[model samples]
Target: MHSFFVWYRVNRDEGDADMVIRGMMARLACRSGVGGRLIRKRDEPGLWMEIYADVADPARFEPLLRQAVDEFDVEMFIDGTRRTECFLAGDAIPAICA
Candidate 1:
């Protein structure tokens, strides 16, 4: 149960941003058995993505991340911000991340 937070600086257009998000969503949805969301900035100009996963072993996601990069076609221009939080439980969750 490793939790990951990913923030992506993306193109201002909503459609372009979805390309990266959709791909990551597909893989994480299946592998982690968890769902994610796409957040567009209200006052700022970026995209934020977050995920929760039941990891058998956290290291296993390394390759998956690479796969997501390809599947999402995340180019160098899209800078990713990530933080790995402690493992998850039902109630300790933050609705922002949910």
Candidate 2:
């Protein structure tokens, strides 16, 4: 399974970012069957992250995620581009990397 972590820095005064993010997450869950968790960085005002774990189908999830971002215009609330990372369990790592 795959897990995705996406982080970004939001615009400081954007009070509506949370609402928009929640809406996007709902849309993503409905469309892709993947629910996400949103969190803020400790002691950091503008840093936030969204985590989606146990993804069995990254191929299907990725495009839906991109689509949701575009549909919700999530970039307007952020200072820069969002950064996304994917991780696999330690036991699932490829033999070539071991």
Candidate 3:
């Protein structure tokens, strides 16, 4: 399995950040081979993150993500510094390293 982590700050001044996030979640939930959870940083009001687990190849999954973002117009609600990181579970965890 592959895992992807995305982090960003909401542009709350533009709209209801929570509502925009929920809309994004709803959109992504309909995609196959992808499952994710949305989270908020307790110490940072506008900061958020999403963790996705997918069995599909990253090549396949990345485009799906891009499409979803475009379809849902996510960029309008997020800050410019949004970031994403990806990993293969077995390769990324120190405890699993030989």
lDDT of 2 by residue, 18-95 (tens): 999999999999998999999999999689999999889999999999999999999999998899999884565566
TM-score of each predicted structure versus truth = 0.60, 0.88, 0.77
Q: Return the top candidate by TM-score.
A: 2
Task: List pairs with backbone clashes in candidate 3.
Answer: none
Error of 3 at 47 (Å): 0.8
Total clashes, candidate 3?
0
lDDT of each: 0.61, 0.92, 0.77
Each prediction's RMSD over C-alphas, in Å, is 5.8, 5.0, 3.9
The local lDDT score (0 to 100) that residue 54 gets in candidate 1 is 59
lDDT assessment of candidate 1 = 0.61
lDDT of 1 by residue, 1-98 (tens): 56655566765555666765676777867875656666656776565655545555557665666577666666543665443354554656567863
lDDT of 2 at 27: 100
Candidate 3's TM-score reads 0.77
Model 1 residue runs over 4 Å out of place are 53-56, 76-98
Give candidate 2's error at residue 58 in angstroms: 0.5
Write down the RMSD of candidate 1 (Cα, Å). Answer: 5.8
lDDT of 3: 0.77
